[model samples]
Each structure stands twice: as C-alpha cells, then as structure tokens.
Target: MAHLSLSWANVAIVLSLCLGSISYGYDFSIISTTVGQPTWYAYMGLTTDPTQASLYSYSNSIIGTIFGLFSAGAIFGGLFVGWFSDAHGRKKSLLSAAVINIVGGALQAGSVHVGMFIVARFITGFAAAMLVALVPVYIAEVAPPAIRGLLVGQHGAFFLVGYTVAAWVAVGSFYSANASFNWRFPLSLQALWPLLLCFFVYWLPESPRWLVSKGRPDEAWKILAKLHYDPKDPEQLFAREEFFQITSQCAADKASYGDVSLLHLFTKPHLRKRTLVATLVMWASPANGAIVIYSNIVVLVAGLGFDSADSLLLSAGWITLACVGNFANAFYLDKLGRVRSMVIGYVGCIVFVIIEAAIVAEYGGTTNKAALSAGVAMLFGFITFYGGFVDTTIYVYCSEIFPTHVRAKGMGWSIAVFFLGNLPFLESSTTGYATIGWKYYLLFIILPALNVGLLIYFCPETKGLSLEEINGIFEDKVAVRLTNLTEEERRDLDSRILDGVVGKDPQAQAPERNNVEKSAEVTLDE
Candidate 1:
C-alpha cells in the first residue's frame, strides 16, 4: 500500500452515492408533473373537479402510504446495512441497493395498473431509504475530519440539484404534449442513473476504517496509504488507534452484527438520545410542509388563480431558487454550526409561512393578480429559507448525531418518520390545503416553531468534531479540554484515540492497555 490522498476516493464515493439521490429526487418531483397531466387522471380513472379532484388526489396519499411503507423497509434496510457494511463492507451494501433500484425502477415505469405502480414505487422507496440512510454514513466514514461537513453536506446539495433536474424535466414533459409518452419518459430515464453508477462505483476503494474493524490490519494500512498517509508511517499506527476507538464504543454499547433491534434503540441510553435527535431533525425537515407545497405547487397556484403554464414556471423557479440555496448551504455549513443553521431556518420558515397564509386569506379566491403574486412570493420565500438552512442541515445533522455502530439504523429510523409525515398530504391536498385553506401555511409555521425549541434544547454543536469525537458528545464524555484543541490536534487525538480502542489486530493486547491508561489519566484529571 502506497500513501495516497483519500480525498479523490471520498469524491468517488460521493458521486456514486448521488445516484441513489437522483432516483429519490426524480420520484418525488415526477408526481408534480404527473398530477398536472390530463392523461394521468384518465389512466387512473378519476375526475379533476376540485371536489372530485380531492378524491383523485387521494392517489397521492396512496403513493405516500407506499412511500412510508418503503421507508419502513428502508428503516430495516438501513439497520441491516450498518451491520452488513461492518460485516460484508460498504461497497457490497451499495451494490445491493443498486440491484433494488434497477428492479424497482423497471417495475414502476412499466406498470399497467395502480397496484403494480404502488408496489414498484414502494420498492424504489425502500432502495431510496437505504441510500439516504447509508450514503451519509459512507461519506462520513471515508472523509477526513477536516472536510467531513463539506463532504456529507454534498449529499443534500446534490439531492437538491437532483430535485432541480426533476423539476426541469417535469416542466418539459408537461409542455411536450406527446400525451402517450410524456410523464413515462422522465420516470423511465431515472432507471439508467443507478445502472451507470454501478460501473463507476467499482473504481472506489472500501472504507479504511471498516477494513480495520474487520481485523485486516495490512489491508487497512494499504487503504490508508492510498488515502495520502505513508504505509509505514506512524499515522497508520494512528489509523489503527482510531479504528479501535470505534470498535470499543460498539462493544461498550453492545452494538454488533444483528444487534440492531428497534427496541434496543429506545432501551439504550446513549442510543436513545441519538435516536431522539436524529428523529427530530428528520421530522423537522419535512414537517415544514415544503414537500407538500412543492409536490402540489400546481394545484396551490391554480387555486390562487394562476394559469397552468405560469404555475409550472413558478414551480420551476422555486426549485431553481432551492438549488441555489442548497449550493450556498453546502459551501457554508462547516462555518455555521448545525443547531444554529436549523434554528435560523425554522424562524425564517415560521415568518414566511405566516406571511403566505396572510396573503392567501386576504385574496386567494379573488381576481387580483397582485394579491396572488404576493402569495406566490411568500411561497417562494418559504422555499428559499427551507432550502438555505433546514433542507441541507437536516441530513448533515442526522448523520453526525449517531455513533458509527448504529448510524445507519438511526438515520433510517429518523427518515422513516420523515416519510411517515409525508403520508397525510398524499391522501388529499385538501387535507392540508382545504382544512387550513390559505391557513394551510400555518401548519408549517407551527411545526418549525416546535423544531426550533427541540434544536435549542436537545441538539449539540458538531461543527469541527471528528467522527469519534462526535460519538463522545453523545456519550456526554467528550471533555471540554478536548474541545479546545486546534483542528490538527483534534485530528491527531482522534486518530490516536481510535487506534487504542480497536488495536492493530484481534490478538494484539498492547494498544488496549495503552487506551486504558490514557482513559484513566483523562478521567482522573477531569
């Protein structure tokens, strides 16, 4: 193994994981276009009158229910992936997700009945669930602590980019007028993305930390050498040390292959706090009503009296703005601590949503274009704030909050809550839109306020911590002294600390003794 900068390898992993996000984005956005199509209702055998439309729109709920179900599958998949990656490796789990993607995409695109489509979407959702749950874990695992935020943040950034592309495609397909082929083309195209990803993923290396955990010290060193550390240098010594820290934490927590019981998540103190934070973050992101608003933008705008083309364009513009916000977030997330970003975002969402509700209440059913424009602008503002902060930060925060042992399970469980929140809107846009009317925006307002409280109360700062140090935060054992270290010092401590936990080999006892001595000294001093 020769010393290589793992930076390139990390980028490779990001690119591969992004394929799954593309599928997620595509599925979510495709519905917006499909909902607008006359043919879609015809195929589903439904009418489009506002009252009748509510029934037709119940299909959205059906889709959402399936989405939630698949998310349930994903919770399992994510939990399994954690142990599987620890046992079989990250690359293999990714390969497994790709296979699910291919099959699910095929079934969805070719469906002749709603049942088949539902089943296909459910499977695809499961695949997406796993991708969302695992990809961040993979990126966090492979990244240098210096750039972990930037790398993990890229997942959300790219996810928004994927959403932008989906919006563009939706708008194009809406205008294409090839009634026979319009929506299907965009849905089917998503299938090719995961297939292409499979080819590229082969070039990427396995996670170096994972290699060490599996007791392959030489192979781990080889990977570390390629990641820009000298094979024979003491850094490999340091790398081994960091690996043990994670393993020891897993053991102390009783985390193991097949140990990912959902009951354990609630019963274990350390795991429970992690689960709480992750679930709240994930729940907060979708509960703001952004997904509902975006998914049904056409109907929302139409209800406000905008023309169909104009509504689609507005949706496109909002998505474009969201992309910009996502980009800005990716660049600055490391600078802004996760809790701060989320708090600011929730505040912004509350204000904007209230304003949108006000505008709609004042003139939603009127013929005044200016009143309608104000409503639209308010909607855009809500999306802008959402994209800027909550959208991007949620994933980064969720992944960072959990220990590596149950990271996947934690993420999966939280995301399942997110999709479960999605289930209501699918049944009837009216469920939210009619029940609240323009006041529907108010529902979003209240949730973010709750999120703001949760973030301030429960969430901890995680701006510059290494993965191991992050675990220490959850355990409440990350010392204040450790927090004062320079970035370089922190990295060195993380590497040295972890090596002591996992040891150089299973039979090696020297590093474990060293860790015990160091831990005692640190504890006594504190």
Candidate 2:
C-alpha cells in the first residue's frame, strides 16, 4: 500500500463545501436592508399609534411579531432539513434550499402588501434554516481532519461577511434617492448566490463516508483516490490499511437507507449522546441573544438616539467589525481549544452586555448624542466578542459532536432548537424594549451566564483529536486523552477511522461498542 498526502483535490473539495456556508450567510443577511424600506412601512399603512387606521402601525410589537414568525419558520425548516439531508444527500438538500431561496427572494422583493412580504420572509427564513442546519455538516465531512476546526470555523466567518455585505448594501440602498426600489434590489440580489451554488455543487462528489455507508466501496475508493490519493496508483493498494479499517467500521454499523430513521436517533446508543451534545451546543450558540440583536440592531440603535441613517451606518460598522472578528476566530480555532474559546467568548459577552445595560439605563432614550454614542460603542463591543468567539465555535463544536452516521441529523436538531430559542426574542423585541426600556440588556446578559455554566459542566475539549476520538469522548470510560498520543499516532488514527479501517480484534471492538453504549446511557440519563 502506498501513502497518499492530503492533496489539492482535497482542498478543492473543501472549498466547494465552503460555498454552501456562503450561500447560508448571504441568504440570512439580505433581509436587513429590505425590511427597513420606507415603502415597506407605507405599504402596511403603518403609524405610530396602534389605534390609528394603519394595518400594523410602526409599533415595535408588530415588527417583533414579524421577526418572531420568521424564526418560527426557521425552526420548522431546520427540523425538516435533517431528514431531507439524510435521505437525499447534502448536495441535493442544499439545492433544495437554493430553490427555496430563489422563490422566497423573488416574492419578498416584489411583495405588494405587508401580508405578502411577511409570508415571503417566512419562506426565506425556512430556507435559511436549511442552510444553517446542513452547511456545517457538509463542510465537516469534506474537510481534512487536520483542518476541520479551521474549515468549520469559516462558516461563521462567511456568515459575518454576508452580514457585512448586507449592511453596506442596505446603507447604499438607503442613501440612494430611489431608495424604495433599491431596497428591493438587495433582497432580490440574494437569489443569484443560491443559483450559483446550485450550478457549482453538481460538479462536486458525494460524501465519501456516505458512499462507504451505502456499501459502494468502489465509488468511495474512486472518490478518495480523486480527493486524497493518486488515481494512477494500484487499485486499493495505496492507503489499503486505512481504507480497510474504515470499511470494516462501516460494515459493522451498516444499515439500509430505510434504516436511517429519526427514531434511531433516540433509540440507538451512539446516536443519542451525539444528539444531546449537538443540541446543547446549538442551544448555547444563539441563546446569548446575539441573533436577536443582529436581526434588530437598527431598532436597538434607534433606542440609543441615533437617527435612521446613522443607526444604519453604525450597524454596518459593527457587522464589519464582526466579520473581521470571525476571520480572526477562523485563524485561531485550532490553537484555542473549542471549549475554552466558547467559554471565553461567553464571559466577554456577559461583561459587554452588563455595560450596554448600564448605558441604556443611564440614557433612557434621552436623545443625548454622547450617551447614544456610548451605547453604540458598547453594542459594537458585544458584536466583536460574539463574532470572534461564540459564533465561530458553535459550528465547529456541532460538527465535531456527532459521528458520521448521525452528523447531519444531530446538526439539524441543534439548529432547530437554536431557532426555537431565537423565535421568542425575535417576536417580542418591541414588547421587551418597551416594557423593560434599557433593562432589556438583562436578557442578553442572563443567557450567556447560563451558557457559561452549561459549558463548564457539559461541554468537552475537542482540540487535536480525530473524529473517532472525539466520538469516543461521549463515553464515560474512554478518558479522551489525546495529549498522550504522538503526532504519527494521531494521524494514523484519523486516517484509519475516516477511511473505515478498524481491526476486528475483540479487544478493540468490545471497548468501542461498550463506549458507544455507555455514552448512549449517559445521554439518556441526562
């Protein structure tokens, strides 16, 4: 057997997977501009007073309700995406999301009424949910084990880039004299990204693991040859040991396509813990009130006394800062243990939220420009900490928590719960702000504290470990001791596990199965 290096073909496959993240990011941020247009309010016949003749008035409650509904749709979409991706494959699921994006974007851009617009937003939100749920899974599967953290971290970086682009686009559209139709252009333009993804994804290969699971060893070998080894090498000779190990593991766990049922997620031992860890990590991801703030920073800024134009500019700036922060996170994720990075981020967010709360309490919507600027600064601080750490870690953590058999489903469940936590805040933003005033920052502060506590107790370190090693961590007895392994041992383990090559020695197989069962029992007990 000949040794194969992780080659350019592998890098190309990873890049192609990363594009799905870009699509997810682009779709998520495009709405910020469109929702703020004057025509949107005018079409709804909005007024300051709810008692007036307007359909929805410029009431915070109405806006919050709209945002909340979108979140709800996303929760449903996330839930649905898991089954879809499992049944249809990641590429096909992504293509489905792209189609939804096109339809939703078109409807939203050309909407003639508030009802139509809200419904369109829901449709778009559903598509965004699918993207969020599946993109990380795709990236994780395709990435080289050595760079999985970095590549998975790139999802957040790309998401912030999408957000930054939307911010600038919003600013430009608002500044244009023909702002009415220009806002529509930003929303409409999102359609192009998904269309591009749909075209390009067809050129990419199916997940090699997925092929192995389905017993198509020849196809899986061909893919591995193209992706990691030289195709001209003797068939099954290069990486034969590694490939045999991987295939053996897959054969041990083999099940038909029909056996990939959601019930298995709960009933199967290996899968149950995976589902729990994925859920917790995802629940922690957006639970810090970051998504609420991201979606409604315009309003939050107005509460700080900035005029609409300045608020938009400030929002744009914050998002740009966040994009930079996300890039920094991508650079550091592998060096910083996932658990540590996430903890540090949550701690920082807690401090910033407290400061922001104080600023809001001191100013109390007082129209004092200095006070408002201070509030904006604090908010920007919050964004910086969030994007740099929490945002990036969530996707990486989710990607690492599950084994190949249930990775997509685990991710989908996590995203669905994330959206569920997000929905209430998105809907009640106006009520939360109006009733609590500047004290609304309390909500953000509280969640991160809870998040930090959860991490301390539940989350585990995943730095410098192979997928199989990480999988072993959920078991009570495996000890998760990667620090003891030599570099060669680590590489060999990763290659063997990923290529489905595990020895049939009872000593090895017994411990692994015992670990899987123990992990499942622990998760159920939790």
Candidate 3:
C-alpha cells in the first residue's frame, strides 16, 4: 500500500501530462456534436432537400472523407513521432506539437469554406496524434514503478474528461442564433489546452530516463534523486542504486542496438516480438469498430427518428459514461493486470454491440422509444467497456514493453497502425451505416471476438514491471521487483544490492548468491 501512494511530485507530473490528453479529447468529441447542429450545417453550406425534416443533406461519402482524412493526417503524425521524439527529445517534441495544434485550431475556428475546414481538421488531427504518442511515453518514463500502469492509464481518463466537456459545449451552443459563432466557439476552445501545455510544461522536469539514455548520468541521477527521496532519508539509497542499474542497462542496450533503425524492429528477434505484440494490441483497439460508430453517433441517432438536438444531447451522455468507465479503468488496471481487464471489456463490447446491431436492424426505422432507448443503452454499455479497458490499456502495454532507446519509435509505429486500422472503418462508416445498416456492425462484432482470442493468447501481463525489467520477459527470465519489500527494508537491501552488482563485492551478494547465479546463467544462455 505504501508503494502505491502518490507523492506531490507524482501528482504534478501526471496532471501536467494530462493537458495533451484533454486537448485531444476536446477536438475528437466536439465534432460529433458540432456536425449535428443546424448552425454547423448552415455555416458549412451543405444542401438540404426541401421535403426532408432535417436541414443538412450532405452525402455519406462526403462525411466519411471529412472524418477519414483526419485519420489519414493522424497516420502521418504518428509516423513522425519516432524520428521527432528520438531526435529532438520528448519536451521539445511536445512543445512543437502544441504550436502545431494552436495554428490548426485557429484555422478551424475561422474557416469560411469546406476546403478550409477540411484542411484545418487534418492539421489538428496530425498534432493530436503526435501528442497522443508523446504523452504516454513521457508518463511511462517518469512514473515510479509501483504506479506506472495507473499513471499511464490516466491518459484515457483525462481524455474522456475532455470528451465530456466538449459534448456539453456542443449541446450548449445548439441554441445560439449566430450560426458561424455557434460552431466557431467550440473549435476555438481547443487552443486553451495546448496553450496551457506550452506555458506550464517547461516548468516540469525532463525525463530522467531520457537524460540517462543521452549519456548525462549526473543530470539523470540528480533528477531521479529529487523525484524519489528526501536528501537525508534512507530511501535515497534505493534511488541511487536504481540510477546505477538504469545507467548500466542503458549502456548495455546502446551497445546491443549499435545503429538503431526502423527495420531493426522487425529484424531483431526480441524487439520484433515486442513490436508484433504492440501492433496487434493497437489493431485490436478498433476491433469493435468503436471509433467509426462514435464518429457517426449523432447522425445515426438522428436517422433513428430522434431530433438533431436530442441526438447531440444523447451522444453527450455516452461520452459522460465513457469518462466514468475510463476512471474506473485507472483504478483497477494494476489489480486485474492488462490482459484480463482488457478481455473483460472486449467481451462486454462483443455482447452489447451484437445486441445493439440486432435492435437497430429490427426497429431503427420506427418511433419505438423503448427499443430506441434500449439501443442507446446498449451503445452506452459498449463504450463503458471500451473506455474502461481498451482505450487505456493498449497505450499502457505499448509504452511499457519497448526499451527506452526505441520507446518513441515503438509507440509511434503502434499508433500509426492504430490510425491505419481505423482508416477502413472511418472510410466506410458513413456509407455503411446508411446502406448496409446494422450489418456493418457485424464486422465489428466478429473482429472483437477474434481480438479477444488474440489478446488471451498473445498479450503479456505487464502490470508492475519497470521499463528496464520488462526486457527479462523477452530474454526468458522471470521479472524481478522490490515492490513487496517494506520501504525501510528496501532502503537497507538497496545498499547491499548496489555493492554486489555495481561494486563487485562478493560479500554483499551472500544473501541471494544462488538466485543471482541462476538468473545470470539463464540470461546468458539466451
């Protein structure tokens, strides 16, 4: 329980990182509400059929392109994260992404034509995707090992907070008489997050792990010391030994890597397995086709005989439930571990999505409130499971599994695959929902069933391991951790362990000599 406690430093780092997540959530959810608004359609100059009750008549293809192109831009952004974060470092990368988002948000708020709006969305999507990749890596690197998974999972919780805010803003703006200003205000608000990030992020400490990777151990040790223990406390000894281990591991890893390249991920056996696992988890993210369903939720609701405003409002509730689910996930992920919790969510999504599709196919065209209410409930249930497990755990697994030398690249490629997987769903969602209807959801149901199987078989459990310790899994050694030690005992053991491992003092290794020799032999055999 003591290991799980959050210090002020931990809270500060986590809250600061959440700015990027909030920014992404706001932009992602606002569109669902905005696109359904009369003011938004009127401002965009979409044509309407005179006899139709709804004023907007944009084709499904047009809507799909508008949404899908954002996914396209995100793919480009994710591709850039590996090089950018590796070359410029994490802080600079995040600062650069903030500037890009500000420019895009400004353009989107002021867009006067469809083309301008489309371009702005692409730019914003690109920025958002980079932030998505950057924030988790930063958090994963800085977090204390005991709570690393919990902190990494916060990305989704905070993102859902932003989603909830956007939904309410869109609903509030529905009554505005000024069509242009109604949609404009929500888009403009996207600037607030990045602005906050840019101004405050500099005050935070750079990742000590990154400092170690760059051969600056003095700075790395100082930062790690400040983050973990009081100057006079016995716990400082553990922090010092931890620094020694990190530097040793980084030097070894650097030698092993030689010249790092993207191809090396596929060519190297252990890294390749790690890469494959990361990629599959990301591919599983959209296995339920949740993103496609969410993007078109407002429109889909309207098509079910609900009014536009009501549809937007109902969509808001779905996001609120998602926020709750995400928070619940952050609480339980460490306890349940990554794979089991995610499987629970996927299983729930599989059941609810099937039920929802059947309801929509049979009763979507009519005005049966009971059926429609049940359908909405099922969609909410799907998101509850999705936001709780898949949204957060996928990023956690991707971030924790990669070595520090290639972490950004590993996560970057995973996110690229994430956006890539979404492309087909995004491109087809609008048209599929209109033409094939709920049968489109059959693809979603089938894919997640398969994904659940893959997750059970392939996904590794990574709840409590340090970033460096995870390497043991690929090398076929058991994970070693000090989490079970009382703080006082850990402080005492750290001194002796450091003497044996770093000082080569055989006397200090007496207590665990046999265990250490066995582990070494196994590691060497690989």
TM-score winner:
3
TM-score of every model versus the real structure:
0.84, 0.86, 0.90
TM-score order, best first, reads 3, 2, 1
Clashing residue pairs in all predictions, respectively, total 19, 8, 0
Please give the CA lDDT of all the candidate structures. 0.68, 0.71, 0.79
The segments of candidate 3 whose C-alpha lies over 4 angstroms from its true place after superposition are: 1-5, 47-58, 230-232, 476-493, 497-526
TM-score, prediction 1: 0.84
Over 4 Å off, model 2: 1-6, 47-58, 230-242, 255-260, 476-526
lDDT pick, better of 1 and 3? 3
Candidate 2 — what's its lDDT?
0.71
Q: In model 1, how many backbone clashes occur? A: 19
Ranking by lDDT: 3, 2, 1
lDDT of candidate 3 at residue 172, scale 0 to 100: 83
Model 3 agreement with the true structure over 388-447: per-residue lDDT tens digits: 877788888898898888899898888889888988888888667766888988998889
Q: Which of the predicted structures, 1 or 2, would earn the higher TM-score when compared with the native?
A: 2
Q: Model 3, 324: alpha-carbon shift in Å?
A: 1.0
